[model samples]
Target chain A: MTVVGYRRPAPGINPDNNSSAYASTRARAPRHPAIRIEHTLSEITGPHFETGGASAIDLTRGARGEALGERIIVTGRVLDDDGRAIAGALIETWQANAAGRYAHESDQHDAPLDPNFAGAGRIISDSDGAYRLVTIKPGAYPWRNHPNAWRPQHIHFSVFGTGFAARLITQMYFPGDPLLAIDPIFQSVADPDARARLVAALQMDVTVAEYALGYRFDIVLRGRDATPPQE
Target chain B: MKTKLTSSQTVGPFFAPLLRGDLSQMVSAETRGERVVIEGRVLDGNGDPVPDAMIEIWQANAEGRYDHPEDMQEKRLDPAFHGFGRVGTNARGEFTIHTIVPGAVPAQSAQSQAIWQAPHLNLIVFARGLLTRLVTRIYFPGEIANDSDPVLCAVPAGRRATLIAKDIERLAADKAASRRLCFDIVLQGANETVFFDV
Candidate 1:
């Protein structure tokens, strides 16, 4: 290993090469190179294929805080490039309940108040990469930056370990909240195709229990390219 | 378990500008202070823009001066390498550089054998939907001196097998002496380049 501190590769491929660029010289030009193919569209990545990461999730019984108001259910699926469900994926969500009140002080806001809702849930993707969570429908809240601004109730999402790109973090917005138009962050994505990825569907919602309103969402996690890419 | 995307009232304000314009501050790690351009693109398997994605470039200046205290050297830097610049890919997922190629740099350690290693650039990527930053490297074409570099040796010969600059015979009309190299880094997926763990 110490020898690597000062060695240069020559014209041909050297099995000893050990750096970011190895054998850069090829008298011939390449239009493109094809590598492996690995892709996904869900919160699914296997351990064999993973990337950068950090801390951990707070799965302990409500350590995030106590429960708050109106009960609701959130459910979703994770898919692959072929649109197949990614099994055993994990889906986690956290939000402010119907009153837009969080159990934590970081969200400091004044709105319809709910003393009992802490807003949080976790569900692992089933065989078809489908996940479900039981919580409450969160209410909209105000933002100081833009006019006519009230953020629709939404939950934050993080997907890790399905290997295509292994790590993903995004937000999920509910239907009919009416405030998607003005939020600068939500509007940052100028492409409607890209923006549509952030919007959760209203039909994915299912009425499973009398006390809970159910919702379904599907996520796509990228997979590794099976072959080397060309130029 | 619950996580908020980025608290609009908290961390949101700091990164929101990235979505609006030239996005100079949104990306870039740091620099030793020079003037130059960096070009590249963020594409999916089908050659598409990972649009609105944040592409950060960090590199050493002409004499190999890094903004990092560790790589901080008195070597005179070219005013052209300017240490940093940020460009968000357009609809096609391509980015270009008006900057100069950086000079050779010393490895990032106090190791006894450390000498000047070959020239290269480090890149970090962030987009609206992905969770973590993607770390990658960009190496110059035909820098034979890299063979024995410590950093290069750290990787396997097969994976190190990738990451080379694509061979080209033509120069841009405007570049009288500008030597150009094309390196298309692969992000793992159905039809993409090889994405490194870094």
Candidate 2:
């Protein structure tokens, strides 16, 4: 593998492109070109916080309430381009409930909402840039972005790096979801390997004896491709 | 080896619960800086309100210092300022941000020697059907520094106005939100907001 310094890399399609057919972009958004700005200490430094306070990762357990669904443990490390762990980075996530229904009022989906599941959590990375979350496997939900369309089972992630420019927000899909093959949001990525980075791998060690299954998802904030080049 | 960065996905319409959290405020009453209210609507190509969108803002403190370790400059860090704010659009596709008027930051490169950025807010927009989050900046109207802002100068002359928020009115004597500004974001039509790559 080749090594590069901490300088932010050049533009890659996955980091820049937004499909035109993506209904929202086609709406009243900018068609103008974006100006590329170099990163500075201002864009490189992020907020610092204590390991724990109100920040918690378990979404399944709320105040005197428990969400109804199959439990799962999602754990991972936040690394830089060099695969070095970045401790204290903030990771926030929001997902739909087990019935494929969101808790927001805007969601007109026919599925019922689970009162106990708020489906949101935030946590600071450990010394190894490691984080663990307990949540239900969100179900696939239908949408009209396209005819007869349904989003695949996935969770939304928002990660804050040292600076404002380092912010990376994306979705995480399950390892074996048939819906992934046809999902437009997944297909918009264009690069197969880049798309694959969104899927978590099963980890037996993290699984609770009878409580939950374990999945590992390690995120590299910026770096040379960790995957072998496509032939 | 060629590493492809992971692509972005929509935050969707369900981020409301998280939006209601306390971190949504960029500056609180205890914050040491001039307070301002940024209000605006999110319109679609058809001039319709995008009621489900979410907006987030990040900026430096009033003293041109960031609340980060890398920004170890001499300016004092305002203990009350966090420099971050988030809000979801209301039914009218409008959102308001209560924040301090950020101070200017220095250019990121030596090539632009002695160049300092005008006070501005970096914004990120999220909504349903948006495959990716839209990034942009809101510059204060009538700021002289804007004329030389390296990033602002990069925009096509006629389109520069799209990035500057217009001053609506100065708040009355007894208010914390000392200034008010309006900046409507057109998602795709005539006056589309200028989105930045970074």
Candidate 3:
């Protein structure tokens, strides 16, 4: 049997591996140009994740108590380039606590870590390609990339779409974050429009009345051709 | 009409605690094929360990058939093999996987002719500094088919060695030893691993 491969990402949508502003990339970006190859069954087939495991969708509470911060609801749909819903996709998320400190041992930020907040969550997209997460607004934190460099408040996301080629690891920034202007990681994408797609928008309709604010962040993965290969 | 794709970001240092399961073991006692052990480290250009990196691998079953609908070939699918594994590098930047040597699979050229790909594992790397995930493949050394593999041939002759894993004797010396191999990844600078854009 023959398979039709997924489309390559549009130019200027992906970040350059050699972006100089991100100090770590200087030592990690490959110098050789990536070899473009035809996709095969290896690229079209990926592992399907089941929701029966210990996956959690809420990040607002822990075994001890509720996390402290402004409660918010984050929800969105996972779609392909043609805007078709991609159901059963796995979405994993992690972030710093409200005090701008991570629960990781490597985090050197002097802020306080919330004992009640592990700041991690995972969920599978529903049949409609929609997912929702309940969590607190993360605070901005400073990194050593540059003097006085503070990343905008954002949640890191790892998404596994339908195929191996559709895997994505990205950050979802909050709207109106002043740090977006100077954040090198956010600016790495050359296209202004493409960069803006990383920021989630405010949506009152998704907000839980008197409970939590709502934000919408839609994601688009690589799409396959409309036609399948002939036998 | 085309919609803009969402931009990528680093996987960050905090993801280790969130990866819920032990995906390092991809085989069971009932699984078929030659048992093999793949071990490696994730390193930076300066040769420092990247402990925060996560690696995911996908490959065919021992019969060279993927457990997906698209792989409609007539090969047998081992019920014990799911052809997937996910793990994070340790504090010392090391990782390991236990699986079998998959059989060669059939591919096609632009003209619909059959082409054979050598036994290999597809890998994806995600780390704290990489805004985008890196895609690569691991091919076993000494496979005669390596000479004609289309993907390997596409790479320049000088750098093809980066994609091949080295046979390590230390791992083979273990009690339950399988075929032990090592393949370290250099994210940049000299001897950087070959990354594919596909």
- Measured by lDDT, the strongest candidate is 3
For residue A36, model 2's alpha carbon misses the true position, in angstroms, by 1.9
Candidate 1 is graded, for docking, as incorrect
lDDT of 3 by residue, B55-133 (tens): 9999998889988777888989888998989989998999998889988887656666778899999999988788788
DockQ of each: 0.03, 0.40, 0.66
CA lDDT, every prediction? 0.46, 0.76, 0.87
- DockQ of model 2, rounded to 2 decimals: 0.40
Error of 3 at A24 (Å): 0.9
Which portions of model 2 show Cα errors greater than 4 Å? Answer: A1-21, A53-56, A62-66, A223-231, B1-4, B22-24, B111-113, B170-177
Docking class of 3: medium
What lDDT, from 0 to 1, does candidate 2 have?
A: 0.76
Model 3 lDDT per residue over A1-231, tens place: 466888887778899888889887887777878899888888888988885433327888788989999889999998888888888888888899998988988899999989999888888888878899999999999999999999999998888887898899899999999999999999988889988899999999988798999999998998886555533
Tens-digit lDDT track for model 2 on A1-231? 111113444333353334665565566345566666655444554566565533337889867688988889999888776666768877888888999998877789999999888888887888888999999989899987778889999998888765566567789999989999988778777667778888988889989897999998876676422331321
What residue runs in model 3 are displaced by over 4 Å at the alpha carbon? Answer: A51-56, A229-231, B110-113, B170-176
Per-residue alpha-carbon lDDT of candidate 1 for residues A75-129, written as tens digits (9 for 90 to 100): 6666654355666554545666667655554456876545555444445566666
Report how closely model 3 matches the true complex, as a DockQ value: 0.66
Q: What is candidate 1's lDDT per residue for B1-198, written digit by digit as tens? A: 011121111112113233334534322434332333444556654444554455545556666655332233557744333444445556566665544456776554446754666776655455533333454556665678668655556555666644555545555664554454555544433334333332
